[model samples]
Target: MDSPSRRPDRTISAMPQHTPPAPVVNDPATTPSALRRHLARWPTGVAVVTTVVDGRPVGKTINSFHSTSLQPPLVGWCVDHGSSQLDDWLAADGFVVHVLSADQIPLATHFANRSADRFAGIEWTAGLDGMPLLVADVPLRLECRVRHRLPVGDHTYLVGQVVDLTAGPAIPLVLQR
Candidate 1:
């Protein structure tokens, strides 16, 4: 697979990184921010969720991808209510979830950005039902058809049945945030 950095992918200017003070666990007052900080200690596998939007490929970087069931081969991920791609994702018939490798940080960052043309010059191909799949040596790729959508709290939970699966890279990409 071609590297996005070597090609003409949208680049997001790096923002300054600062570590906030961790909240006291013993304290009774646990704010939302504190809860977030506490959970950031546990890293998750980074995933890039891709689907077609009006004949063009669109993707979003996510760390919320997880297995739902084994009996029916179900998987799930969440999208924030405020995400611009929420409507497109919710309406998509099928999608591809590319679990990134550690070396695919560039791809993850590209999809996470707010750029309208995330796939500009990025190598990709069509999967099941014309769903877009990134041309990367990822850890795992699941071609899924939408099975359920449950709106809960600030994000909508999307569940799908895995119609196809592939594996490539060895090292999985994990991040605290």
Candidate 2:
């Protein structure tokens, strides 16, 4: 019997080629609903990004706050593009990032309200450059000065250089969505 190795008709070109489908290009605006749903799965700590404008205190509750750098101590948070207080926050000399305690959900809710006076019944003190620091017995507080501002999509990313910080024994408030 002739060995199969003696066959010469077979060649590498005898195999069929397969091509992958074109990648899907989805517009960001078209998928925001899904994106939002996906993002809600992530858990984050809550903070009130506070600053003083002129003679009064102003702030907004946010979970977008995070540390950006270690050297020179940088931190950041995002403000909505259409926020009324965006200008005040950008113009302020300094601001404070109050990392709320788990028991301070009321403080977070208070700041989240747009129509309410955030500091009306809340007790707070002035931090660096007289920026309002909510005295909610939080786990951590950072006094920072705006270092950079970048407009991205529907939000303004504000990066601040930490000037001072304080930490407490309280547990931080965490949230999902």
Clashes in each model (backbone N, CA, C under 3 Å)?
Answer: 0, 0
**Per-model TM values vs. the true structure:** 0.81, 0.81
Model 1 worst lDDT run, 10 consecutive residues: 23-32
Residue runs of model 1 more than 4 Å from their true location after superposition: 1-30
Best by lDDT: 1
C-alpha lDDT of all candidate models, in order:
0.89, 0.87
Tens digit of per-residue lDDT, candidate 1, span 1-177: 778678877769878988998975687437767777878899899999999868878799999999999989999999999999899988888779999998889999999999988888789888887888888788899999999999988899999999999987479999985
Q: Candidate 2 residues 1-177, lDDT tens each?
A: 768888767656656778987766874635868787778799999999889888889989999999899998999999987887888877877779999999989888989998646788888888888889887788999999999988989888899999889999999999986
The pairs that clash in candidate 2 are none
Residue 170 Cα positional deviation in candidate 1, in Å, after optimal superposition = 1.8
- lDDT of candidate 1 vs native? 0.89
RMSD of 1: 15.4
